[model samples]
Target: MRARLMEATVELLVERGFAGTTTTLVSERAGVSRGAQLHHFPTKNALVVAAVEHLTERRGEELSRAVDALPAGGNRTRAVVAMLGDHFASPVFAAALELWVAARTDEALLAAVAPLEQRVGREAHRMTAAALGADESRPGVRELVQATLDLVRGLGLASTISDDSTRRRRILGEWADVLDREMARA
Candidate 1:
Protein backbone atom coordinates (compact mmCIF):
# COMPACT_ATOMS: atom_id res chain seq x y z
CA MET A 1 0.00 0.00 0.00
CA ARG A 2 2.75 2.43 0.94
CA ALA A 3 4.70 1.54 -2.16
CA ARG A 4 1.64 2.04 -4.32
CA LEU A 5 1.09 5.50 -2.86
CA MET A 6 4.69 6.48 -3.50
CA GLU A 7 4.54 5.14 -7.05
CA ALA A 8 1.40 7.12 -7.69
CA THR A 9 3.02 10.22 -6.24
CA VAL A 10 5.96 9.90 -8.64
CA GLU A 11 3.67 9.32 -11.61
CA LEU A 12 1.61 12.38 -10.75
CA LEU A 13 4.71 14.45 -10.14
CA VAL A 14 6.19 13.48 -13.47
CA GLU A 15 2.92 14.01 -15.33
CA ARG A 16 1.86 17.17 -13.57
CA GLY A 17 4.47 19.14 -11.68
CA PHE A 18 4.36 19.86 -7.95
CA ALA A 19 1.65 22.45 -8.25
CA GLY A 20 -0.71 19.87 -9.68
CA THR A 21 0.17 16.80 -7.62
CA THR A 22 -2.16 17.04 -4.67
CA THR A 23 -2.74 14.44 -1.99
CA THR A 24 -6.19 13.86 -3.39
CA LEU A 25 -4.81 13.25 -6.85
CA VAL A 26 -2.18 10.91 -5.54
CA SER A 27 -4.77 8.97 -3.54
CA GLU A 28 -7.04 8.76 -6.54
CA ARG A 29 -4.21 7.61 -8.77
CA ALA A 30 -2.99 5.13 -6.22
CA GLY A 31 -6.54 3.82 -5.65
CA VAL A 32 -6.08 4.41 -1.95
CA SER A 33 -8.15 6.47 0.41
CA ARG A 34 -6.97 9.90 1.49
CA GLY A 35 -6.95 8.70 5.07
CA ALA A 36 -4.68 5.82 4.09
CA GLN A 37 -2.26 8.19 2.38
CA LEU A 38 -2.19 10.44 5.41
CA HIS A 39 -1.64 7.45 7.63
CA HIS A 40 1.36 6.45 5.61
CA PHE A 41 2.80 9.81 4.61
CA PRO A 42 1.40 12.34 7.09
CA THR A 43 2.00 15.30 4.78
CA LYS A 44 2.39 16.19 1.13
CA ASN A 45 6.05 17.04 1.68
CA ALA A 46 6.61 13.69 3.29
CA LEU A 47 4.93 11.91 0.40
CA VAL A 48 6.85 13.85 -2.24
CA VAL A 49 10.17 13.40 -0.50
CA ALA A 50 9.56 9.70 0.00
CA ALA A 51 8.57 9.33 -3.64
CA VAL A 52 11.79 10.98 -4.81
CA GLU A 53 13.90 8.85 -2.53
CA HIS A 54 12.10 5.69 -3.57
CA LEU A 55 12.49 6.47 -7.26
CA THR A 56 16.13 7.41 -6.90
CA GLU A 57 16.94 4.21 -5.06
CA ARG A 58 15.09 2.15 -7.65
CA ARG A 59 16.85 3.91 -10.54
CA GLY A 60 20.21 3.43 -8.85
CA GLU A 61 19.55 -0.27 -8.58
CA GLU A 62 18.46 -0.43 -12.21
CA LEU A 63 21.59 1.44 -13.23
CA SER A 64 23.73 -1.03 -11.35
CA ARG A 65 22.03 -3.91 -13.10
CA ALA A 66 22.50 -2.28 -16.50
CA VAL A 67 26.15 -1.57 -15.84
CA ASP A 68 26.66 -5.11 -14.64
CA ALA A 69 25.19 -6.48 -17.82
CA LEU A 70 27.67 -4.67 -20.07
CA PRO A 71 30.33 -6.77 -21.81
CA ALA A 72 33.62 -6.79 -20.02
CA GLY A 73 36.75 -5.23 -21.60
CA GLY A 74 34.88 -3.42 -24.35
CA ASN A 75 34.13 0.30 -24.87
CA ARG A 76 32.80 1.01 -21.38
CA THR A 77 32.80 4.76 -21.92
CA ARG A 78 30.34 4.58 -24.77
CA ALA A 79 28.27 2.03 -22.93
CA VAL A 80 28.14 4.19 -19.81
CA VAL A 81 27.19 7.26 -21.80
CA ALA A 82 24.44 5.38 -23.56
CA MET A 83 23.12 4.04 -20.29
CA LEU A 84 23.16 7.50 -18.69
CA GLY A 85 21.51 9.06 -21.72
CA ASP A 86 18.65 6.60 -21.41
CA HIS A 87 18.44 7.32 -17.69
CA PHE A 88 18.31 11.07 -18.19
CA ALA A 89 15.61 10.66 -20.78
CA SER A 90 13.51 8.55 -18.44
CA PRO A 91 10.36 9.45 -16.50
CA VAL A 92 12.44 9.23 -13.32
CA PHE A 93 14.56 12.14 -14.47
CA ALA A 94 11.45 14.07 -15.39
CA ALA A 95 10.04 13.52 -11.93
CA ALA A 96 13.30 14.57 -10.33
CA LEU A 97 13.41 17.69 -12.49
CA GLU A 98 9.96 18.66 -11.26
CA LEU A 99 11.14 18.32 -7.67
CA TRP A 100 14.27 20.31 -8.43
CA VAL A 101 12.32 23.22 -9.89
CA ALA A 102 9.94 23.25 -6.95
CA ALA A 103 12.72 22.96 -4.41
CA ARG A 104 14.38 26.13 -5.67
CA THR A 105 11.79 28.35 -3.97
CA ASP A 106 10.27 26.14 -1.33
CA GLU A 107 12.50 25.93 1.71
CA ALA A 108 10.62 22.97 3.12
CA LEU A 109 10.89 21.12 -0.15
CA LEU A 110 14.55 22.07 -0.44
CA ALA A 111 15.22 20.82 3.05
CA ALA A 112 13.65 17.50 2.17
CA VAL A 113 15.16 17.15 -1.28
CA ALA A 114 18.73 18.39 -0.79
CA PRO A 115 19.99 15.36 1.07
CA LEU A 116 18.29 12.94 -1.30
CA GLU A 117 19.81 14.82 -4.23
CA GLN A 118 23.24 14.63 -2.64
CA ARG A 119 22.87 10.89 -2.06
CA VAL A 120 21.76 10.36 -5.66
CA GLY A 121 24.58 12.57 -6.92
CA ARG A 122 27.12 10.59 -4.96
CA GLU A 123 25.75 7.32 -6.25
CA ALA A 124 25.79 8.65 -9.82
CA HIS A 125 29.42 9.71 -9.44
CA ARG A 126 30.37 6.36 -8.01
CA MET A 127 28.51 4.54 -10.77
CA THR A 128 30.10 6.64 -13.51
CA ALA A 129 33.57 6.13 -12.07
CA ALA A 130 33.03 2.40 -11.92
CA ALA A 131 31.47 2.20 -15.39
CA LEU A 132 34.32 4.17 -16.96
CA GLY A 133 36.89 2.07 -15.10
CA ALA A 134 38.30 5.35 -13.86
CA ASP A 135 41.27 5.57 -11.57
CA GLU A 136 39.90 7.86 -8.92
CA SER A 137 43.34 7.83 -7.30
CA ARG A 138 44.52 9.86 -10.26
CA PRO A 139 44.33 13.65 -9.84
CA GLY A 140 42.26 14.55 -12.90
CA VAL A 141 40.04 11.52 -13.12
CA ARG A 142 37.54 12.66 -10.51
CA GLU A 143 37.01 16.01 -12.20
CA LEU A 144 36.62 14.33 -15.59
CA VAL A 145 34.04 11.95 -14.20
CA GLN A 146 32.11 14.88 -12.71
CA ALA A 147 32.30 16.77 -15.96
CA THR A 148 30.90 13.81 -17.81
CA LEU A 149 27.98 13.62 -15.41
CA ASP A 150 27.38 17.36 -15.68
CA LEU A 151 27.34 17.18 -19.45
CA VAL A 152 24.95 14.22 -19.50
CA ARG A 153 22.71 15.96 -16.98
CA GLY A 154 22.54 19.06 -19.16
CA LEU A 155 21.75 16.95 -22.18
CA GLY A 156 19.07 15.16 -20.21
CA LEU A 157 17.52 18.50 -19.21
CA ALA A 158 17.43 19.57 -22.83
CA SER A 159 15.73 16.31 -23.73
CA THR A 160 12.91 16.97 -21.28
CA ILE A 161 11.38 19.74 -23.41
CA SER A 162 12.57 18.74 -26.89
CA ASP A 163 13.85 15.84 -28.94
CA ASP A 164 17.55 16.59 -28.60
CA SER A 165 18.65 13.01 -29.16
CA THR A 166 20.70 13.79 -32.29
CA ARG A 167 22.65 16.57 -30.63
CA ARG A 168 22.92 14.60 -27.41
CA ARG A 169 24.23 11.56 -29.22
CA ARG A 170 26.82 13.66 -31.01
CA ILE A 171 27.90 15.32 -27.79
CA LEU A 172 28.10 11.99 -26.01
CA GLY A 173 30.32 10.59 -28.72
CA GLU A 174 32.56 13.64 -28.74
CA TRP A 175 32.75 13.74 -24.97
CA ALA A 176 33.58 10.05 -24.78
CA ASP A 177 36.33 10.54 -27.33
CA VAL A 178 37.72 13.54 -25.53
CA LEU A 179 37.56 11.77 -22.19
CA ASP A 180 39.37 8.77 -23.58
CA ARG A 181 42.09 10.99 -25.03
CA GLU A 182 42.50 12.94 -21.79
CA MET A 183 42.60 9.78 -19.70
CA ALA A 184 45.25 8.35 -21.99
CA ARG A 185 47.35 11.45 -21.34
CA ALA A 186 46.85 11.18 -17.59
Candidate 2:
Protein backbone atom coordinates (compact mmCIF):
# COMPACT_ATOMS: atom_id res chain seq x y z
CA MET A 1 0.00 0.00 0.00
CA ARG A 2 2.81 2.40 0.88
CA ALA A 3 4.71 1.67 -2.30
CA ARG A 4 1.59 1.99 -4.37
CA LEU A 5 0.85 5.40 -2.96
CA MET A 6 4.42 6.56 -3.43
CA GLU A 7 4.45 5.37 -7.03
CA ALA A 8 1.20 7.14 -7.65
CA THR A 9 2.62 10.30 -6.13
CA VAL A 10 5.61 10.14 -8.46
CA GLU A 11 3.37 9.73 -11.47
CA LEU A 12 1.17 12.60 -10.41
CA LEU A 13 4.20 14.75 -9.75
CA VAL A 14 5.02 14.28 -13.41
CA GLU A 15 1.45 14.90 -14.51
CA ARG A 16 0.82 17.80 -12.21
CA GLY A 17 3.37 20.05 -10.60
CA PHE A 18 3.82 19.91 -6.82
CA ALA A 19 1.28 22.66 -6.26
CA GLY A 20 -1.26 20.51 -8.06
CA THR A 21 -0.35 17.06 -6.72
CA THR A 22 -2.72 16.50 -3.85
CA THR A 23 -3.13 13.45 -1.64
CA THR A 24 -6.50 13.02 -3.25
CA LEU A 25 -4.90 12.51 -6.66
CA VAL A 26 -2.40 10.04 -5.31
CA SER A 27 -5.06 8.05 -3.51
CA GLU A 28 -7.24 7.99 -6.59
CA ARG A 29 -4.43 6.95 -8.90
CA ALA A 30 -3.22 4.26 -6.52
CA GLY A 31 -6.72 2.79 -6.53
CA VAL A 32 -6.54 2.69 -2.76
CA SER A 33 -8.89 4.11 -0.24
CA ARG A 34 -8.09 7.53 1.17
CA GLY A 35 -8.08 5.99 4.61
CA ALA A 36 -5.30 3.62 3.54
CA GLN A 37 -3.16 6.48 2.29
CA LEU A 38 -3.81 8.52 5.42
CA HIS A 39 -2.87 5.49 7.48
CA HIS A 40 0.60 5.50 5.90
CA PHE A 41 1.09 9.21 5.35
CA PRO A 42 -0.96 11.71 7.29
CA THR A 43 0.44 14.54 5.16
CA LYS A 44 1.33 14.79 1.47
CA ASN A 45 4.78 16.06 2.40
CA ALA A 46 5.47 12.78 4.17
CA LEU A 47 4.80 10.90 0.96
CA VAL A 48 6.93 13.27 -1.11
CA VAL A 49 9.77 12.88 1.35
CA ALA A 50 9.47 9.12 1.20
CA ALA A 51 9.48 9.13 -2.60
CA VAL A 52 12.50 11.42 -2.67
CA GLU A 53 14.32 9.21 -0.18
CA HIS A 54 13.67 6.16 -2.32
CA LEU A 55 14.96 7.94 -5.41
CA THR A 56 18.11 9.12 -3.62
CA GLU A 57 18.94 5.61 -2.47
CA ARG A 58 18.34 4.19 -5.94
CA ARG A 59 20.42 6.89 -7.62
CA GLY A 60 23.29 6.27 -5.21
CA GLU A 61 23.26 2.58 -6.02
CA GLU A 62 23.23 3.29 -9.75
CA LEU A 63 26.14 5.71 -9.43
CA SER A 64 28.14 3.20 -7.38
CA ARG A 65 27.60 0.57 -10.02
CA ALA A 66 28.65 2.93 -12.80
CA VAL A 67 31.80 3.93 -10.96
CA ASP A 68 32.70 0.30 -10.32
CA ALA A 69 32.22 -0.55 -13.98
CA LEU A 70 34.40 2.21 -15.34
CA PRO A 71 37.90 1.43 -16.81
CA ALA A 72 41.05 2.71 -15.13
CA GLY A 73 42.39 6.15 -16.28
CA GLY A 74 38.80 6.02 -16.01
CA ASN A 75 36.92 7.95 -18.67
CA ARG A 76 35.20 9.95 -15.95
CA THR A 77 33.71 12.24 -18.58
CA ARG A 78 31.87 9.44 -20.35
CA ALA A 79 30.70 8.04 -17.05
CA VAL A 80 29.38 11.41 -16.01
CA VAL A 81 27.70 11.88 -19.38
CA ALA A 82 26.02 8.50 -19.22
CA MET A 83 24.82 9.13 -15.70
CA LEU A 84 23.42 12.49 -16.69
CA GLY A 85 21.84 10.96 -19.76
CA ASP A 86 19.98 8.37 -17.71
CA HIS A 87 19.01 10.86 -15.06
CA PHE A 88 17.69 13.51 -17.44
CA ALA A 89 15.66 11.04 -19.48
CA SER A 90 13.91 9.65 -16.41
CA PRO A 91 10.38 10.67 -15.39
CA VAL A 92 11.37 10.46 -11.74
CA PHE A 93 13.43 13.60 -12.25
CA ALA A 94 10.23 15.35 -13.31
CA ALA A 95 8.86 14.47 -9.89
CA ALA A 96 12.02 15.84 -8.32
CA LEU A 97 11.58 19.08 -10.23
CA GLU A 98 8.14 19.45 -8.75
CA LEU A 99 9.42 18.82 -5.26
CA TRP A 100 12.21 21.35 -5.76
CA VAL A 101 9.72 24.08 -6.56
CA ALA A 102 7.54 23.15 -3.62
CA ALA A 103 10.46 23.14 -1.21
CA ARG A 104 10.85 26.85 -1.66
CA THR A 105 7.58 27.54 0.12
CA ASP A 106 7.29 24.47 2.31
CA GLU A 107 9.59 24.27 5.27
CA ALA A 108 8.92 20.60 5.92
CA LEU A 109 9.76 19.73 2.32
CA LEU A 110 12.99 21.72 2.52
CA ALA A 111 13.94 20.02 5.77
CA ALA A 112 13.41 16.61 4.24
CA VAL A 113 15.39 17.45 1.09
CA ALA A 114 18.35 19.40 2.51
CA PRO A 115 20.15 16.45 4.02
CA LEU A 116 19.71 14.26 0.96
CA GLU A 117 21.01 17.02 -1.26
CA GLN A 118 24.07 17.40 0.98
CA ARG A 119 24.78 13.68 0.91
CA VAL A 120 24.51 13.48 -2.89
CA GLY A 121 26.59 16.61 -3.33
CA ARG A 122 29.33 15.18 -1.13
CA GLU A 123 29.38 11.92 -3.04
CA ALA A 124 29.59 13.74 -6.37
CA HIS A 125 32.43 15.90 -5.12
CA ARG A 126 34.28 12.82 -3.88
CA MET A 127 34.02 11.28 -7.35
CA THR A 128 35.34 14.37 -9.11
CA ALA A 129 38.05 14.96 -6.53
CA ALA A 130 39.29 11.37 -6.69
CA ALA A 131 39.32 11.44 -10.47
CA LEU A 132 41.32 14.67 -10.52
CA GLY A 133 43.70 13.51 -7.77
CA ALA A 134 42.61 16.42 -5.63
CA ASP A 135 42.13 16.11 -1.88
CA GLU A 136 38.55 15.62 -0.86
CA SER A 137 39.18 17.98 2.05
CA ARG A 138 39.69 20.91 -0.30
CA PRO A 139 36.83 23.24 -1.26
CA GLY A 140 37.93 23.62 -4.88
CA VAL A 141 37.15 20.02 -5.76
CA ARG A 142 33.65 20.31 -4.26
CA GLU A 143 32.97 23.66 -5.86
CA LEU A 144 33.92 22.40 -9.30
CA VAL A 145 31.66 19.40 -9.03
CA GLN A 146 28.86 21.56 -7.71
CA ALA A 147 29.08 23.74 -10.78
CA THR A 148 29.18 20.69 -13.01
CA LEU A 149 26.21 19.14 -11.28
CA ASP A 150 24.23 22.34 -11.62
CA LEU A 151 25.02 22.59 -15.30
CA VAL A 152 23.93 19.03 -15.91
CA ARG A 153 20.82 19.43 -13.82
CA GLY A 154 19.84 22.62 -15.59
CA LEU A 155 20.22 20.90 -18.91
CA GLY A 156 18.07 18.06 -17.60
CA LEU A 157 15.38 20.53 -16.65
CA ALA A 158 15.51 22.10 -20.07
CA SER A 159 15.19 18.69 -21.66
CA THR A 160 12.30 17.71 -19.45
CA ILE A 161 10.31 20.89 -19.92
CA SER A 162 11.23 21.94 -23.41
CA ASP A 163 12.27 18.74 -25.15
CA ASP A 164 15.65 20.28 -25.88
CA SER A 165 17.77 17.36 -27.04
CA THR A 166 20.31 19.74 -28.50
CA ARG A 167 20.73 21.38 -25.10
CA ARG A 168 21.25 17.97 -23.53
CA ARG A 169 23.94 17.05 -26.06
CA ARG A 170 25.58 20.42 -25.58
CA ILE A 171 25.71 19.91 -21.83
CA LEU A 172 27.27 16.48 -22.29
CA GLY A 173 29.82 17.93 -24.69
CA GLU A 174 30.69 20.64 -22.22
CA TRP A 175 31.26 18.04 -19.50
CA ALA A 176 33.49 16.13 -21.87
CA ASP A 177 35.59 19.22 -22.45
CA VAL A 178 35.92 19.83 -18.72
CA LEU A 179 36.85 16.22 -18.14
CA ASP A 180 39.47 16.30 -20.87
CA ARG A 181 41.06 19.34 -19.32
CA GLU A 182 40.96 17.93 -15.80
CA MET A 183 42.24 14.50 -16.80
CA ALA A 184 45.09 16.14 -18.72
CA ARG A 185 46.07 18.08 -15.63
CA ALA A 186 45.79 14.96 -13.51
Q: lDDT per model, in order?
A: 0.88, 0.72
Over 93-143, each residue of candidate 1 has an lDDT whose tens digit, in order, gives: 888998989999999999989988998999999988888888888889899
Candidate 1: 10-residue stretch with minimal lDDT:
72-81
Error of 1 at 38 (Å): 0.2
Which candidate has the top score in TM-score? 1
**Tens digits of per-residue lDDT for model 2, 47-158:** 8878766775677567667766767665666666657655756787788778878887888889987786677667766665554454435535555556766776777777
**How many clashes show up per model?**
0, 0
Worst lDDT run of 10 residues, candidate 2, spans 131-140
Instruction: Give TM-scores for every candidate, taking all chains together and pairing residue i with residue i.
Output: 0.96, 0.80
In angstroms, how far off is 5's CA in candidate 2? 1.8
> Which residue segments of model 2 deviate by more than 4 Å?
73-76, 127-139
